[model samples]
Target chain A: MAEVRLTTPISEEEIRKLKAGDTLYLSGKMFLARDEAHLRAIEMFDEGKELPFDFKGLAVFHCGPIVKQDDTGQWHVVAAGPTTSSRMEIFQDEFIERFRVSVVIGKGGMFERTTAAMKKYGCVYAAFTGGAAVLAADGIKKVEGVEWLDLGTPEALWIFEADNFGPLTIAIDSHGNNLFKDIADIAEKNRPKAYEIIGASKE
Target chain B: MEFAPIIEKVAFNLMKYSATVLPDNAIKAIKTAYEKEKSTTGKAQLGAIIKNFESGAEKSTPMCQDTGIHIYYVEIGADCPIDDLGKFREALTNASRKTTTEVPMRPNAVDPFGSNSGDNTGRYIPWINWEIVSGDKIKITAFPKGGGSENMSTVKMLKPGVGLTGVMKEVVDWMISAGGQPCPPTVVGVAIGGGADIAIKIAKKQLMRPIGEPHPQKEVAEMEQKLLKAINTTGIGPMGLGGNITSLAVHMDYAMRHPASLPMAIAVQCWAARQSAAEISADGKVKYLHHDIKD
Candidate 1:
């Protein structure tokens, strides 16, 4: 797997070259927007309202993070874990197409719609480590701000400036390669042999 | 013997501790998983999970944003003085409030009718399963069930002739198909031979066993090892990045089944398998099992 470092205002072309299993260390601004924020953005697009922020080249993280205040009362993310990425399958394609997002970061594999959209839209889907919220937060230099308080803290949009924010792997690339599907195919081929080994072990 | 009050207190504390501790297990498993994972992608995901758990624990945070449905397995003694289980239920509701705020668990309980409880407790504060035993002590185990892994659990009612081979295929297929959806590396809990509902219950209960522990019965132990190997061989790996180890353990609990049916249930625990227990006596003696909470 190749490792690439990303800075602010990444080009869509750069995202297209990423392949499944390629590691990326992202330093720059990334936006946090879970289901509610996504829906809201879609609503805004439909209503012709001014968007919350510029959407081009933005990386949207699928997360609803837990927040806590420190001894100094500075709010910090306690566990900013990625929610299952597939849950956003219905909206990902449309969201990417409309927003021109350079990257989509979350856990698990995305759907065919997302992968196809990424290929067409010059974007990539990155799989962040599922449970490593603390390590993910360590990459955050500061939280720039937040939006959608009514959506609750978890659903709110958290904007952060990050430094080497990932060891994120590109699960779905612009070339139509999907790491999740590839792995599944390999596993399925070995299923019968796996069963045989299990049988013998049981005996 | 006025068992309602005591039951209430026990259930209440159980719910509170369950929310906080269950994620601890998730964190531990994920960290271990990251270290052992061979897949580059899987290791990356495990690293993220490790960060998530560390942040949750250090910040007194909830491990997953989804705090999950609260499930309790209650083992009540026959000689216990508590006559009414209802009071314990009420106590559980009260405890749920403290847990939501203290553990800062996500408020996941929503009314089926579109009303949000805001607090974790609503129609069912804590889902309860009761086991009446011939004893004087009451023991309760709490599993804070997250939606990701819970969504992956499966149950199948097989004819007796289908036997162990059929069971193995189903379990492995279901999990390998799950890929990274359930957040690997997962702990697989298999409940075999019980009736439909009991089988599912046993599967969930089996997850309470510590990682790497084997079944007491020799045949069952062999089955557990076999399933463990088979699942790992799927190469679903840690976080589905593709690796050598997909599962940390395979735990099974069994009960006698009907002559014609062999029911099997698979309960998958995400890397973050959060669970805790509390045992209370009629004289007010309390023992904390599994998770150790300071203060």
Candidate 2:
């Protein structure tokens, strides 16, 4: 796995090289958004209206973080951990295609539709640790801006510049491989033996 | 003496405590998992989660942004003095507001049709399960269950002949399909041999067991270990990023069942499995009972 640093304006090619199991240390600008923002984006797109920001080559993080302000009025992320990505599965493909998003950062693996979208659109789905919000916050160099305050802090869009932002692994690669499904398959194969053990123990 | 009011108070308190205590377990488990994790990325992720929990606790913040829905399982003593159960409900509703402000749990309860209850308590804000026991002390266990994990729970009824093999197949299959979706690595709770509702209750109760603690029954203990090993072989690993530790534990609770009906339930507890217990005595004394809480 190659360790590459990403900046605000990344290329689809940069994302295509990533595969399931590859790791990345992302840098530069990234946007935070979740269920609400996704719905809003979809609405705007369907209405054929202009979006608040450009979406091409952008990275969207599936997170609703708990942030705190320190003594200096500087905001520190208390828990900026990733949310479950599969919940976004329904909208992910359309979101990627319409927005030209290169990387989708979140926890958990995306579904088949998302993996297919990744391969077709030259994108990748990378997973940061689900519960590791504090470490994720440490990757942020600055908070560039914010928007959509009506959704509240957790649901609002916060723009941040991060340095070496991840040890994130590719859960869905450009080749359409999904780590989540593969693991499930392995677990299924050994299930019978597993039952026998449990049965024997009961005796 | 009515019992409803006291039951309500107990339910409310359970919800509050469940939300507040999640970070401790999440941090502890992540740190331990990191040290033992075989995969490099998994180790790194575990380390990050540990740091997050530390900061969340140190700052007195909720470990996760999703404070989750309030769910409580309560056992009331037969001899306990409770004049009004409705008062208990009122107390729970009132306590929910206090806990929301104190623990600062995210206001998650909403009216099904519309409208948000900013205080986190509303009609049925804290879901309650009640049981009457013979003792003079009331015990309450609270689980601040996240939607993600709750969505992954599964229930099935097998023919008696299908036996333990059927149970293992169904449980492991569900977990595999749930990989990373329920936020692996997770702790799985299995309840077998009870009626549908009771099976579900037992499954959730199994989650209260401490991580790595073996079940008291030798057979159950072996099943737990076998399932754990089988799940890890999936390579779903930590955080679904792929690793050796897919599950930290598998706990099960069983019950006697009908001759022909073998019902089972699997409740998935995310890595952030937060639970705490409390007991109230006849004299109105209260005690916090939890795995980590010390006197």
Instruction: Report residue A172 deviation for candidate 1 (angstroms).
Output: 2.2
lDDT of 1: 0.77
**Tens digit of lDDT per residue, candidate 2, span B114-202?**
65566667787777677899988778777778767788898888888877866776776677678777777788999998699989889
Candidate number of the best DockQ: 1
lDDT (Cα, tens digit) per residue for candidate 2, span A118-155: 89988888888776665787788787777785676667
Task: State the TM-score for model 2.
Answer: 0.84
Count: clashes, candidate 2:
10
List of chain B TM-scores, one per candidate:
0.89, 0.88
Model 1: native contacts recovered, as a fraction:
0.58
Candidate 1 lDDT tens digits, B147-232: 77888898899888868877887887788788888888788999888699989988988888878779999999998998888888
Error of 1 at A10 (Å): 2.9
Position A33, candidate 1: lDDT: 86
